[model samples]
Target: MPEETPAGTPEGTSTARVGGTVDVGGLALTRVGFGAMQLERLEGDRDAAVALLRRAVELGVNHVDTAQFYGNGFVNEVIRDAFGDDDGVTVVSKVGATPDPGGRIPLRLAQRPEELRAGVEDNLRSLGLDRIPVVNLRRADSGPGLRAEGDQVVGLDDQLAVMTALRDEGKIGAIGLSAVSLETVRRALPVGVVCVQNSYSLVSRQDEELLRLCVEQGIAWVPFFPLGGSFPGLPKVTDTPEVLEAAKSLDVSPAQIGLAWLLHHTPNTILIPGTADPAHLEANVAVGSLRLDAATLRSLDAVESRTGDIVLD
Candidate 1:
């Protein structure tokens, strides 16, 4: 848990509740939090990364999601530099994977017990947090292992043991799972789950069942890649004709409509739309304020539920 502090936001900044609060390890978090994946040079330009993070907090985002593997500590450093000792913020970071020094994405899984411990330590040193509010174990692959595999590598039980030890030692407040299937989530629930981070959006509803489970269980559902994947030909929820029409009718942007749809679809759903542009960051926060009516929501649901060949995996 973050240290006690004032209630108001930074100077000239404002906050809007995207939805009601949900408790994560006794911490009440806003439904709309910030994803710090864009705070890296993977997509190019560190200046833009810094600007977006600063803009996110300035727009009243308190819950922040990051991972040590994201840019190999660069993203966490960005968060530390932006919000230094602001008790109003909660930083949730993950371990399990290690990024390749020569590239932007992670190389492979190194989630042994010792590696998980080291990852948590590195995250603390990078983010300057003594206790991470939420620590998620990010699995490298989603589906089942090989048929002939013996003594499965990176077992969920093993990972949960490490996380349980960390929580018992007061190193982390809550534990979560990321980039895994609903089966993985169900298996880890015995270890006490607080959140589930998955690649979910209008275009990619592969984890819809898991999302509904989180809603029913009162666990926070943090959706990464909310805009669907990389740009140029990104399969975005905002690009759908139904979403565009709903935005037009509501006099709001398509992005805002997408966020509104997620906010209304489930109370436990938390949209983490990442952007490197400050203007886009402000606009993304404004999404929390847009409310879609029943008619527009039904139209969006109909269009989005139609299965297409645009797979996110």
Candidate 2:
């Protein structure tokens, strides 16, 4: 069984028993959180993204996931600007990579221990927080020309050791891994992993096994791209016929149905669906109230993806 909460506290505040908790230090968090990737100036304007982050908290989202590479510090700034005074929020940021001088989307890896430390310090400076709730090691194979400037690439084990040291020093509350393989997750488990963030959706179930392991181990499983990638593809999760039908039955949008499926699928699954529009943010938060029955969930699970396997590690 999971650890029990002390008496007299609110149910979801500290324990989050309904949705399993991912321990950031000793803090337990709800599985459903917000991903702040979309808060940057992607297509043009950033007002929509700002509104979305603000509305997420208004709608009861406590966990906010971000990275130093996101918009070269734009996302973190937005988060800090939005909820700097709100003590109820838990802001999670990642290190291990930094944006190029010219400003880029995908970041260049800075795997050296010193570079990692600087990245964490930069995150603290940007988020305006003494210690972030969780810090993930953002691992990527491509984008930007920055490389690990050492004789060897920093392995997952080495990264975990760095994060563990930081955690012990109270610089970060918990440690997590992003865009890593199941093998990497297993390797880092002994170092104390609290959560895993991967690209998973109805159309992308490649991380199914990793999600299951997180549930069994009482770790939080946060999915990044819940709306598929940024392209027009076949109806995967949100655009599926079955999902649309279920949404129609529930009198909600397809996105809500998709998020509902994630929330109901497992107690550990957390959906961090990002959006620039405040309307979309409100819709995303409304998903928490939408429930999928067993039949609908089964139908959603039955829907298959035609795309190639999603490999983030």
Candidate 3:
């Protein structure tokens, strides 16, 4: 539980009744959550980013997904600045991708125990937390296992060993994996994986198998890009026939329909839609209220699954 604070967001945003809670390990997180990636787009405005994070908490958001690679570690700093004293907020951060000297993401994968240990330390320092509640070991496209062996990939056990050791040491509370396949999740079951974050959305169904696994195991499945991201070659939620039809019938925006579908799609699924705009943030949280009927859900299911072509950004 987070310590009581006197701060409050602007009027009319409403408390976090938008979505119910899902237990990520022992922490019951609101199904609708916030993502700090957009803080990078803020162009280093620490105050604006901090205010946004604090507002999310005021509106009942307890789960915040952040990463050290975001804004060159600026996003985690904003989270620490905004909720450093709030124990109620569960900050979920990721490791594996590191920024190079040119400030661009390198192809390097942090899989070794020592490398992962340093990544965990970086997250702890950036977030100013004694221990991050949930730390996801993101599987970069290079695949899991040691990076020293080129093109000869190893299994996740070696990496899970490092994460589990950190959990025992009290540096992290729960372990999760991002952009992993069903096989990886199965291999990680014994490691006590509590959650899985993937790029799943209305039009993105590449991780259907993994989502099903999480549902069966009662693990939290957080979809990073619930709304189709603006990246090129990705299918927009509004452009999808089923999503558009649902939006028109439901009298809500396409994005709202998309988010609502995700909430109804799986009980364990949690949303972390990132937005720098307060109005957009409020709208995202309010997506919990837009319910889709069975027919809409069926139509959505029938929509051709094009997620295979969409690459993770």
Query: What is every candidate's alpha-carbon RMSD to the true fold?
Result: 4.9, 5.1, 4.9
lDDT of each: 0.72, 0.70, 0.77
- Which model scores highest in TM-score? 3
Q: Which digits, one per residue and each the tens of the lDDT, describe model 2 over residues 1-313?
A: 2233356645434233223434544666545567787677552555656667766766667778888778878888877877866448888888877676553335566776677788899899888889987898876532112344553287766777778888889999888887777888888888778878776778767778888888777777777766565333323576679988998998988878877787777766667777776777766766655657889888898988555433332
Q: What is the lDDT of residue 159 in candidate 1?
A: 79
Model 2 local distance difference test score: 0.70
What are the TM-scores, per candidate, against the unseen true structure? 0.83, 0.81, 0.87
Ranking the candidates on lDDT from highest down gives 3, 1, 2
lDDT of 3 at 146: 19
lDDT of 1: 0.72
Worst 10 residues of 3 by lDDT: 1-10
